[model samples]
Target chain A: MKVRVTVMLKDGVLDPQGKAIGHALQTLGFDGVHDVRVGKVIELDLHGAGEEETHKKAEDMARNLLANLVIEDYSIEVVS
Target chain B: MKVRVTVMLKDGVLDPQGKAIGHALQTLGFDGVHDVRVGKVIELDLHGAGEEETHKKAEDMARNLLANLVIEDYSIEVVS
Candidate 1:
């Protein structure tokens, strides 16, 4: 199975990198561009794991290393 | 409308950060964890734009700001 995990900054978090990119876009003449928030996606390929086991593993991966839960939120999707 | 842009390291790209994260996961006792690749997602909220316009804007954003096309691949979705 394949798993996709998306980790994003929580609302109200200050995203300096996103802000910098937004500024760059405006400089490049992209009109009507507003706020830009950047997050992360982690794609995983698992072997010999059922959906239940894979979900648990993916959650553990997110909490342990993939995302900083204090400032980021994560969601996982399993593709069989 | 809102837009989601996902950017990922291309196949065969060396992702040192992802490797480090994978190593950390294994050290933390995550069994069966294999390769891990980290990517990015950018969310945008736009004002006064139709779906077609938003799609065009999103493509421009991906090309000019959100992604490094040389080493990364990106996809965009427009949410109305």
Candidate 2:
């Protein structure tokens, strides 16, 4: 099975990197670019796991390794 | 308009951070977790832009600020 995970900064958190990019975009003539929030996408390949088991495993992967729980939240989508 | 951009490491590139997470997931008892590749997602808010303009602007943003062209590639989706 394959899984895709997206991890994002929680709302209300300051994203310095995103902010910098927003500013840079304006400088580069991309008018009207207001705010940018940056997050992460993780793609995984798994073996020997069913759908339910894979979902659980993907969640565990997020909670334990892929995300910083204090500042980030993650969602998983299974493909194939 | 709103745009979502996802940036990912090019295939065959070494993703050290993702590899570390994959190892950690195994340690945390996530069976069948094999390979992991990490990427970035960016959400943007724009004003005074139409869909075609927004898509072009978003691409400029990606090329100028959001992605490292040497190691990463980005795609954009417009919503709202």
* Candidate 1 structure quality by residue, lDDT tens digits, B1-80: 88999999999999988888778877998767677788988888877899999989999889987789999999989966
Per-residue lDDT of candidate 2, residues B1-80 (tens digit):
99999999998999998898888878777767778898989999999989999998888878877889999989899988
Q: Lowest summed-lDDT stretch of 10 residues in model 2 chain B?
A: B25-34
DockQ scores for all predicted structures: 0.77, 0.84
lDDT tens readout by residue for model 2, A5-77? 8999999999998898788878877777778898989999999989888888888778877889999989999
lDDT of each: 0.87, 0.88
Q: Looking only at chain A, give the TM-score of model 1 against the true structure.
A: 0.91
| Model 1 spans > 4 angstroms off | none
Best by lDDT: 2
Name the lDDT of candidate 2: 0.88
For this target, which candidate reaches the highest DockQ against the unseen true structure? 2
Best by TM-score: 1
Model 1 per-residue lDDT tens digits across residues A9-72: 9999999988887888889988787788889888887667999989988998889888899999
Query: What TM-score would each prediction reach against the true structure?
Result: 0.93, 0.91
TM-score computed on alpha carbons, candidate 2? 0.91
